[model samples]
Target chain A: MTETVSRCPVAHDQLPQPAPLPFVSEDPFHPPQRLGELRAEFPVSRLLYPGGEIGWLVTKYADVRALLADPVTFSSRNRQRANPIREMPEDFKEQPPKPGLFINEDPPDHGFYRKQLTGQFTVKRMKALEPRIEQIVADQLEYMAAKGPVADLVADFALPVPSLVICELLGVDYAERGSFQEWTATLLNLNSTAQQVRAAVDELDQFMLRLVKQKRAEPDDAMVSGLIEAQDGAERPLTDEEIAGIAFLLLIAGHETTANMLGLGTLTLLHHPEQLARLKADPSLVDTAVEELLRFNSIIRVGQLRVTTREVEIGGQLIPAGSSVVASNLAANRDPEKFDNPDELDITRGAVHHIAFGHGVHQCLGQQLARIEMRIGYRRLFERFPDLALAIPLADVKWRTDMAIYGLHELPVTW
Target chain B: MRVELERDRCCGAGMCVLYAPEVFDQDEEDGLVLLKIAEPPDSSLDAVRTAAGTCPNSVISIAG
Candidate 1:
């Protein structure tokens, strides 16, 4: 029942015995309860992939960090397209990752593409954009204020803030945000059929192709034009298709993750009134609050999936070569070993060590930008609407269970 | 404590800068690790150690 070449003779026998990956969480704010139980009794256990493959599940905080820290032992290739929670389309199996999809690439290829954009997302660079991000946040707050005594924060403020920021950063027209959001939502939906995913990918590709061509013809101050300008000096410049792929990734990644965070984060604050009161009492808590919020609500519910390239021991379990492994980011963040009162919301926890942005070479490229957005978004939000309250009861709030990224479908709120 | 850096291996994840901004910075042009202090004071050791441990590329090394 196991593929691991166990160092301990009884390790295979001790396996929680190949249960399916836990994707559903009973409580919207926390990871799946089964995952927490496994973290307690069996930090490293076997999981059944949707494709009928047995993989290792690493749930301990320390183990998850170690697993992600070493790229050599564990590869991100996903060559089998072995998703832990869902079966992938047959066409995706055994296919080389598309160019500019460096997230799946290892070594030199990943570095080559990552280096091109790293400068743009550096701590200082992202910090420089703080005032602009603050302006964007304030403008959204104003828009929401104009539209409400009642408003869906998801639609009015949370979604548009990151969407506008990312759109401006990429030089894409914000007017076309509706289509981009739809395409990306389709792409990110875990239940999206292969045909729907293909259609979304095709539409996004066509849109990016046109945008890249437009940037090439006329340079601008944004990232796309910057890429085109850099190409001239690059030894092996990326092709137009590669550029389009990169743009497509950034567009989807930039907006969706943060948009979900904003919507869900507001809801989280509303649920934890004491924490919210603490933040309002001391607005400076925004910095640590954002980090704590990130830790508490680890939005990437699917976890970071990797495949072992060689026989390796993680948390005393010997995982065999060529086996899929999932590092449960959500569980890791909530580990009692790493965090004090792991399940509670404490904004002052200063939870910077959480792997919400992940770790290692593929650690989120726009984390600094995301941080800046969240800091400003949450601070200005509470400051502006001092009497903000939820329009619906906490139990009635709809959680986004369909998408790979966990968040709220809509946060109905009023001042 | 003394620190050594292999800048080329830096993935520019900025974990180092985030942890030890006083001792590390990212180059403006490429975002590679730029060590500001080769031998930082003992007061900065914890932050530096955390930075080294969390660096995605494992490019930072510490020596006594």
Candidate 2:
């Protein structure tokens, strides 16, 4: 504590302001070059958050992993309370989301809900889903071939494939995808107005609530239905609100993150034709390629928000208790200490250790599904159209820098 | 190589299965690591090592 006080002097305000936590890059495929330097120089730096608060910005690979793994010292529960960019209005009277969202919870509660869905996302389960996913990929490619010479890959393929798959898995109607996609887009956009975000969230919740009610009355083979059935059979059944919360999380997380990955991953491959050619020549590289793509892009730019629950020492710096901390996945994935030639994207690199899906207890549950989708999606897209290339110049492509999930807004491609 | 897993510590990140599917599987109930072959052949030793190293929970260990 004495050391911590000495390092962070009483006149903190008078000291030079540290670089802001969220590093906005003009190039969405690559994070700001300064982040690498920061990771090397100041792995744990005091920084200003968008909400006008100072917090710890952790950039090094080992440090980021350490903080993420120790949820006891750094709690995800602070995400709602100490969000740098507050999403809700100060006077908004709606009750905060119940502790049912597993990602936001800590310890026993997180494990309780997460374990319930773990079996559903196992490698075997995802492997079983691979064939159906392949058909979905094939169908999308077939449609693209029929409509092409030119197409916006994001809308025509990237977004819909996952949307449809998730819809089928969740038992949500595929026809409702357009509205939900819009809602998700708005809800995740960093630049979106609070009112716009709230409206989108309300719409999504209402739809999920209806679906939960429907599932309660009549269960089916989908994940949501399975959850409902589990709830009914349990000694202490989950409330409809809890069930709806789970469904809502799955619906958005199930599609949004993967959709962005597909769009951005394709764009990244297109930028490096040599890599694309190598992948096209050897389809078996799909698995490793997906891992590399995930690592190279590391789409969730700023990583997850956490607050130190107790005084923690990281990268030789003391992060005071209750301080907001951001572990940059973008930085960690590119850590020179972790990977060789970190900036270069080599599909054959086999970067299995990367923290793209994140690390520790709250790692992405849908990761296996996302990997299979990418594997099938990339393989089928390249296989079907051997001459696939971008329809528009790389400069013209719109990057979703304003969104929480980093990716291309529209990737126009031509065969 | 003989592979071992501390099932209780498994958080189901699935890196082991992804890297060395031939040597590992996950429980259908909770996604915990399940060793398919306790002593995999020489050909799979490299993959087994990768799986052990990549596991976030460090649940997997290997010894001859």
Candidate 3:
């Protein structure tokens, strides 16, 4: 690499040595052990990306918050270039995100798509779905009860509860969940090859396109149908492609995140028996427990990747324009300065401040819905099966170590 | 407590509504922050502070 004089405050040679991201930890609930050390020594540590680019991993709570809050300085538009966990598809590295896939976009383009759907996910709207969510949770528990004595909770309960909720919400036929679920698993897998990811994307696109057409022909009250009928402030109604793109984004995002949280969160509680006892003893602690679980799991383990749009200082390190940065929420949530006992699972901690749903303009859109699912999902699960325990040995449980979204592959449980 | 809001900056994450529904809400059309009570009662002070502090867009501010 040439020692070129650019916007960097220091010479290229003077920059900190880049280290590969620490990927594993002995404890499933905790982030990689090295992250804590790095957060202490270098909150904005230099990182070597899988594509052989040098990036920065931001681990401090305040710095992560600041970095995400300023989306203009640290833009999401170039996320493909900054992902430290895996090499993104080369074809997509420079292309602007497909219309309606606003998570990859910066405002006002992002807000254009986001705002259209924001009303659909408002707290009030999500709260209104509580009765339906309770029914879904209850029905799933009944399904589990019938299949129990030995059940993979990931399939029998955790996955289905959110899957059914999102399916009903999006106007997708719940019967077809198997196909989308398979494709999403492949898409979110960190180890998926470029070709495999491309294939999954193509399949999902086709599926959503067909669904969008159906919704147009036979409109329903669900989100996809609502999106089709309501243009909001757009100059023209959303095109078929844009609607399909939006549906595709929501379909994958809607289920996988909350499903994983449910699976992994249940496991986390099982591991922490005392905490589980407190939650079971007092069901009212469900809200705080959900927040704490989100904090503790930090399931979006790859962190929110962004490229600096200009030279900016994060944690005192001046990152130059176009440089990649991974804001490590996993480390941020566990920052000692922010929480009294960062790693300890304390359901009463009221960890609402943790950025598990992330921070800023592009924070998780379905957060309210996810919270509702978790709160209801956990309470119902424990209430239905008070003696729930792992049917298989802890070591036998398959962790989603290969995925961008952290979760359990199969959570074998019994009452 | 007097709650100040920059509705234009509100990204509609609904943390404010979740924390203090009495003081904040999302507009029916755009889901932007809609202040229900600019000066809330003392009973809701703690919840209002949380709403201001945790709003994703930091669009909410509180003053005595």
Candidate 4:
């Protein structure tokens, strides 16, 4: 059993006015040299949501992982926007209730929605799409080469591959990926206006709703159509609204994560030419390199935030019920105790286990699909331009300076 | 060795299939490993090991 680390609960409780984010996790919030300082310094610091209200930020790997895993101890439902900064504007209430995918809901609701998605992300399903992923990567790279010498890899290739794949899976019009790309980016911006956030969610729901209607009329070889066929009962098949919720989850959760992984992952490989060479020599290294890349630079700053429903202990620290929490996936992957040389980029280091895809019940559903996409992307990109190198020094390349997604905003490269 | 699971300990994190799809499958409703192979082939031993190591919990084990 793990115990929660303690902080000034009274201080958090008394904080009527939540402070704005000084910087999002992706930025040089602190020095890259001191990436895990939040863990050692505040262990469990305070966070201000989009609203001015405060939430707890858990930094330790074990603590964050345990909190996210132990749903009985830590609750996620109705924990969306932390307690109001002052008073939530009535306008805030105008936004529709967030579609309760298993990501935010605790069981038995978590179990229910999760059940709906389980069959869809299985390895068999994902592996079937391997060739398509390879083809997608090859096509994108070909498109870039035809465009010639200097291309922004992030824009030209990395971003579109996952965007196209998710669209195809959910039965959305893949050709319209360019628009979906922008909307999704705005939604993930931590400091985006509330109206903007609400609009993004609403637009996604509408997009998904249209697909659901199309799938109902004529099924296809996609998850959306497969789901339309899955019947829970004779009369009580899932409603359109419910279908909207599930598609919304897969689309929103699946896309950027893979995009960020591919973009950031390519950057990592470029920075470490030795590792890239090792991987190119043996494509088998792609699997292990993926894990190393994930650990070296994690997915989310913290996977997801949870609130204690009852007094809970994690990693030996006890947290009071209703306290806010975040599981720091970045800190956990870098936890020296977990990896042999946690900081090293060794593609051959097969003894790796990372929480990049997360741990516990809410682990990423798109992980299998993501793995195939990344591996195929890496294989094709490296093979096509074995001389592929960053056009600019890493110091000059810009990463998203204020977002939860750690990614290169523009990965400029030339062969 | 046989791969076994403590179903109650499973939180539906699907690491098993990634490592050994031949040996593990997911429930239709939940993503928890459905134990497709009780006695995995010798060639799949490495995958089984990866599955056990990858499980967030120590829920997966190989016992003779």
Best-matching candidate per DockQ: 3
lDDT of 3 by residue, A169-252 (tens): 999999998899999988988888888988998999899999989988899999999998896675867888888999998888
- The digit string of per-residue lDDT tens for model 2 on B1-64 reads 7888888878887878988999998999888888889989999988998988777767889987
Give per-residue CA lDDT, model 2, range A213-283, as digits (tens): 99878889999888887775677677777778888888899998899989999989988999999999899
- The CA lDDT of each predicted structure is 0.88, 0.83, 0.89, 0.72
Per-candidate alpha-carbon RMSD to the true structure: 2.1, 2.6, 2.7, 4.2
Q: What is the iRMS for every candidate structure?
A: 1.4, 1.2, 0.7, 2.4
TM-score of candidate 1 against the unseen true structure? 0.96
- Best first by DockQ, ranked: 3, 1, 2, 4
Which CAPRI level is candidate 3? high
TM-score of every candidate: 0.96, 0.93, 0.96, 0.86
- Where is model 3 more than 4 Å wrong at Cα? A1-16, A232-234
lDDT of 4 by residue, A1-415 (tens): 2223343333334433433323344343222433366555555656666555456666566676666667767776745535322233456644444564557777776766776776777777778898888888889999999985789998889888998898888888877776666777777776677678778777877777887898888888888887778764535467778878888888877778888888889988888888888888898889888878777777576356677888765554455777766666777676666666667878777745788887776777788888889888888888998899888876798877556577778888999
- Candidate 2 shows a clash count of 0
TM-score of chain A of 1: 0.97
